[model samples]
Structure formats: C-alpha cells, structure tokens
Target: MEEQTIFHIINNMDKVTNNLIVQWNKVFEEDLGVSHILVLGHLKVHGKSRPSDIAKILGLTPPTLTYLSEKLVQKNLAKRLVDDSDRRIIHLGITDKGIEVVQRANQKGVELRKRLFEQLTKEERKQLLTIYEKLNKSL
Candidate 1:
C-alpha cells in the first residue's frame, strides 16, 4: 500500500473507533470511565493478575493503573490483594459485585453492538471479525 493509502486508512480507523467509543459512553453513562470498565473487563477475563502485568497488558503506566485500581477498589468493584508468597506484589481481581456489573455492562454493550452493526451483512461481519483476530494476533 502507498503511504497515503495507509495514512487514510489509519485516519478512518481512528474515526470509527472514536465513534464507537462515543456510543459506548452513552450506553455506560453511569459508570466511572471507560478505562475503569476496561480494567474490570480485563480482570474479569483473566482472573486475578498482578498490577504490573495488568498495566502491561492494558498498555498503561503504573500511575494510571494505580489511579484506576484505586477507584475500582473504592467503588467495591475490585479488590487488591497482596501476593501470599510475595508480600510486595499486588494482585487485582474483580469482586462478585464487579462481576455482576461487568455482566450487565456486557449485556448492554452487546445490545448496542447489535444495533451498531446492523448495517453490515453477515459476510461483512465475519470478514471484520477475521480481520480483527488477525490484527490482534499480530500485536
């Protein structure tokens, strides 16, 4: 691809992502922030994980992770635990309440996504999913 074509595609992708985020925000208006929801989602998916590992996975700085974690902990959505074997290491996990919240959020997101993707044909959706998986694996 030409540099111009790549740049255009990148710009278009950014717009699409931003638009979806805006829609998601509307659906999750009661939540704290997308970052906190994202953190909870990660913990929900992978179970308990160290703060450093979660930060690395989420492409966040330590301070950013700390801020999000603190907020979640205070909200009673997640808990921070010290490693049983390594006292200094901190692990973060979603609480049962957090699971319920994540589940409801996911349900709402799925409904929004269904409406959002209604314009796409099934074949297009399949192709998009394949593209997303390929891109995800490349990272």
Candidate 2:
C-alpha cells in the first residue's frame, strides 16, 4: 500500500475508535471505567486468574491491576481467592454481580456497534470484519 493510504487508514481507525469510546461513555451508565471492565471481562472469560497473569495478558503493570481489582472488590463485583495448596498465591474471580455487569456491558457494546455500522451495507460490514481480522492476525 502507498504511504498516503496507510496513513488514511490509521487515522480513520483512530477516529472511529475514539467515536465509539465517546458514544460508550455517553450510553454506559456504569461507574466503572474501561480498565475495570477489561479486568472483569477477563475474569468472566478465564474464571479465576492470578493477578500477575491478568496483568500480563492485559498489558498492564501489576500495580495497575491491583488498583483496578481493588475497585472491583470494593464494588462486590469480584473477589480474591487464596489457593488451597499455596496460600501465597492469590487469584481474582468475578462474582455474580460482575457477570451481570459484563453482560450489560457487552449488550451496550453490541448496540453501539449496531448503531455505528448501520450506515454501512451488510457486505461492507463483512468486508470490514475480514479486514480487521486480518489486521489482528498480523499483530
């Protein structure tokens, strides 16, 4: 691809992402921020996970994860679990409330995506999906 095309694609992708985030902030009524929701979503998908592992997977520092997890625990959305065999090891797990929140967040995300993509034809949406998948694989 030419340099101009590449720059245009990158710029538009950033604009689209920022727009979605702005819209999400307007529509999402939760007190939690994106990082907190990311941690909860990770727990929802992987069940109980060590703080270190979660931090690594999420590209966050251990202390940052601790800060985010603390908020979740305080909100009763998540809990800390001590390993039975290893008391030194701590894991975080999502609570029932956390699951509910994740579901609601996902629903909001789906609705936002629908609204944003509604302007495009179905074929265009499919093409965009394919392009994104390819780009993700490259990463």
Candidate 3:
C-alpha cells in the first residue's frame, strides 16, 4: 500500500473508534468505562483468574487492572478471593450482578452496531466484514 493510503486508513480507524466511544457512552450512559466492562467480560468468560493473569491477558498494567478491579469490587460487580493453597495469591471473580451487567452491555453493543451499520447495504457490510477479518488475521 502507498504511504498515504496507510496513513488514511490509520487516521480513519482512529476517528471511527473515537466516534464509537462517544456514541457508546451516550447509549449506555454507565458509570463504568469500557476497560472495566472488558475485565468483567473476561472474568465472566474465564471464571476466576489471578490479577496478574488478567493483566497479562488484557494487555493492561498491573496497577491499571488493580484500579479497575477496585472499582468493580466497590460496585459489587466483582470480588477478590484468596487462594486456599497460597496465601499470597489473589483471584478475581465476577459476581452474579456482574454477569447481568455484562449481558446488558453486550446487548447494548449489538444494538449500537446495528444502528451504526444501518446506513450500509448488505453487500457493503459483508465486504467491510471480510476486509476487517483479513486485516485482523494479518495482525
């Protein structure tokens, strides 16, 4: 690809992500940020996980995960558990309420995508998906 074409793609992707964030915030109007939701989603999928493992999987700093987890615990969405065998190890687990919240957030995300892509024709949408999948595989 030409240098200008690559730059354009990068810039457009950034703008699209920013716009999506704004629109998502407007629609969800939640107190927690996307990162928090992501952590909850991860827990919901993987069951209980160590803090360090969660940080590594999410590509987040330990302190950042700590902060996010603290907020979730405070909100009663998640809880920290001590390992029975190892007193030093702490595990993070999502609560039942957390599962419910993640479910609602996921539904909102689906709704948001439907609304956002409503302007595109079916063929255009399919092409866009194919392109994204190819790009993702490359990465």
Q: Which lDDT values do the candidates have, in the order given?
A: 0.88, 0.94, 0.92
TM-score of each: 0.81, 0.90, 0.93
Instruction: Give the clash total for candidate 1.
Output: 0
Which candidate model has the greater lDDT, 1 or 2?
2
Instruction: Write candidate 2's Cα lDDT for 20-139 as tens digits.
Output: 887887888988887888999999999999999999999999999999999999999999999999999999999999999988988898999898899999999999999989989999
The candidate, 1 or 3, that scores higher on lDDT is: 3
Ranking by lDDT: 2, 3, 1
Tell me the tens digit of each residue's lDDT in model 3 across 17-122: 8888777778776698889999999999999999899999999999999999999999999999999999898999999999998898888888888888998999
Q: Least lDDT summed over 10 consecutive residues: which range in candidate 3?
A: 21-30
lDDT of 1 by residue, 75-114 (tens): 8999988899989888999999888888877877788778
Regarding lDDT, does 2 or 3 come out ahead? Answer: 2
Q: Would you list the rank order by TM-score, best first?
A: 3, 2, 1
Q: Please report, as a residue range, the 10-residue window in candidate 2 with the lowest summed lDDT.
A: 25-34
